[model samples]
Target: MRRPATTRAITRATTLAAAALVAAGSLSACAVGGSDDGPLVVVSTNILGDVVENLVGDEVEVMTLMKPDADPHSFEISAQEAARLRSADLVVSNGLGLEEGLQQHLDAAADEDVPTFVAGDVIEVLEYAEGDAAGTPDSHFWTDPARVLDVVDALAPVLADLDGVDAGVVEEQAADYRAEVEQVDAEMTESFASIPAERRALVTNHHVFGYLADRFDFEVVGAVIPGGTTLAAPSASDLADLVGAVEETGVPTIFAESSSPDRLVQALASEADVHVDVVELFTESLTAPDGGAPDYLTMMRVNTERITDGLSA
Candidate 1:
């Protein structure tokens, strides 16, 4: 027997619809300091949210739109939250078309003169070289810790200048945090250097590791999905070709994206008839507080360790 939906469900639907309408409405309705909830910084992804929180400390409130273990490409915010974007003290996003659904909202905030920092803008961006997505900018720049340093360089000053926040604390934290990033970068270099370059080939759920490959001398042998984004579907021939690549490359593992399902990669491994292992990595999103990857540094270190371990096997 079917159970009828409750009033709470109907109220939730109405709230989302209202938010959409507000998001689509005039920016003129946006108020000064948009959130009375307190000194606020709104970030599009949990990863960047963690970065910003580290810089700001407890001086301000950080509103992260995307939850842990969620895909950033297709995630959307409430219209009310979209409206709040225009009013926040600062907005940070990993811009290169990574936030597919939320780009318009980011743009709206920028259009309203909200000082928005895009991670892609500060870092040297990589473009897709082949396929239909050829020439499209890859937004997965955080894969390289060095490029993320560029992001920190560009944002540190802007964050220091925000009103109601202690500039000294921001600078101090940024420097300390940058040092931590540098240390991690050195460790990753030393560790991955141990792996034979030929053995350092990779296959992922999607085209996500271009920067990481470029930085660490790893080869992006192939992907289960064809494009830079996860929403892409693979044709049978695509899977067949990837299977052949796997066989030829002798790559040992196919990394299942943490934010996405591994069923496809699992099936791909079976279909390819290869004895490859499928491993999960926190690729795009962070995890809950108690999960394996709770922040950017931990996420990168965990991935580095896993990648090294997998390929070295």
Candidate 2:
């Protein structure tokens, strides 16, 4: 006997639905793709996640919403990770408008009464120039090791309050980390001082190194993209202007952020019609444990050496 049309249609619909359910389940199974166990600390970016991991030191679970080397400005969390943020014992974020896509989720987590800590809240913030960023605040605080020391200082006390955490351990780890940060700072300061005054100029893919510039006394000639975030693209005239700045400022290298595309910075260097080198630096994100910049201290040290070499060349 032949099946009725209605029965056949229903069978097809059911099969489609089951397939959809399986696919959805698979996606949800690895939602946000991070570790989860013990008291949870959900951080917005991998950089901060590394810091939190070091500070907490297995006392509690640490889950970073952003993937390794992901751009903090535009990286977003999954719905499941957003839910985790809401339920996490503490949600730590860079704040200062850095996580543009994740800001709403951070706010949602805070609204749900989850304990939240904004690293920008404790550290001093820098602003863009009058015509550079339309008056946006600079959000790349981790560029400055001194400021990262400030982050460690702020998080140590807050993390100590989490249940099952030992305050003594937190303080000790924080103190050790601060010393490391200071050591890197001193090393970078001395390394950067070796560059001649005329060679201390910088031109990057974007306005990423403001904190580094301010801390180390390097002049930010300009960026290929005239803003703090990489989401903004450059107009022909913007590239033209940066090319002129590169030539006029005598920038030896146009530093491209490791996390951002180098096409535009390359274009600027190519347009400069000079022998300007385009050097890659781990500016915003941390690499995997096996990568050169696996942690904050290593990242800073690597970038310091790269910048020092690139500029002094």
Candidate 3:
């Protein structure tokens, strides 16, 4: 049975409250400049924040700066958030230039000798063309469930050390989540494999699917924005070239992120005189609880279904 949104929200709130209780003394210890019993981990993006919360469960106090649907690239942190970052026992960031606004806070925390984990650093980064300004290691690795399992593997030990938590329990939970991620990965692989190889190329607003393409053997021919970050605007010529590429490649689908407007891709599709499907994917942020891509697993599954169905059609 599908859980109601109110019930899910209440469940999430209750889980968070439990985690808060477990980490309260640890947070207090950190506030008093003493040894912390548990870790206060702050995630820069809500997507990573969700994964962190899942891995840690109710064992650690996990706070996220970016809310649901918040744009991670341009998100601004308030003074209270800055204080939270400063006092956090550990800080987890999506990294790879995803948190442009929170970089300073992360650096500040690093300066204070707090343990910081960049989830991107754990995965093999996919780089873009040399002259392309949007070429940074794509920060959306969690789009691939296997890569998220890798993150859970990396996060297990860090989460286990938090105060008021049983290390064994945390490790056990992490293992269980990792198994689930593996199952999701296998399912996605099978689902994506249903699409013929020739139809597997992807064109999106930005280079958000590097990990997915790499994992699933899909060719990312080009992006409308031609960069790693979505903040860059595509030049008229860039659009022309991308449209031309789309025409030549005959890829009927053009993906746009939930946080980005589809106007540019829509215009390009019209100009190219080809039918383009501008499917929305949860790239930088997860959808609201009631929306389609509320969690990591569902987000990837929805994206996979869209890509496979669109391209296959």
TM-score of predicted model 3? 0.86
lDDT of each residue in 35-80, candidate 1, tens digit only: 4534678999999999888888877788999999889998889988
Model 2 spans with C-alpha error above 4 angstroms: 1-37, 130-132
Worst 10-residue lDDT window, candidate 3: 128-137
TM-score of each: 0.86, 0.86, 0.86
The lDDT per prediction is 0.88, 0.86, 0.82
Query: Given candidate 3, what's the lDDT at residue 249?
Result: 86
Candidate with top lDDT is 1
Give the alpha carbon lDDT tens digit for every residue of 176-261 in model 2. 77787789889999999998889998888888888988999989898888888888877888878788888888878888888999
Comparing 2 with 3 on TM-score, the higher-scoring candidate is: 2
List candidate 1 segments past 4 Å from native. Answer: 1-38
Pitting candidate 2 against candidate 3, the one with the higher lDDT is: 2
Query: lDDT by residue for model 3 over 1-313, one digit each (tens)?
Result: 9999999999999999999987997777676763344567898988888788878877777889998887888889899989989999889988888888778989999999878888988887777652275455777788778778778888788788766778898888888878878888888889998998888898888877778888889888788888877788888888888878888888878888887888887877788867877777777788789978788778877887888898899
Ten-residue region with minimum lDDT total, candidate 1: 26-35
Give the runs in model 3 whose Cα sits over 4 Å from its true position: 1-38
Clashing pairs counted in every model? 1, 0, 5
- Clash count, candidate 2: 0
Q: What is the lDDT of residue 199 in candidate 1?
A: 88
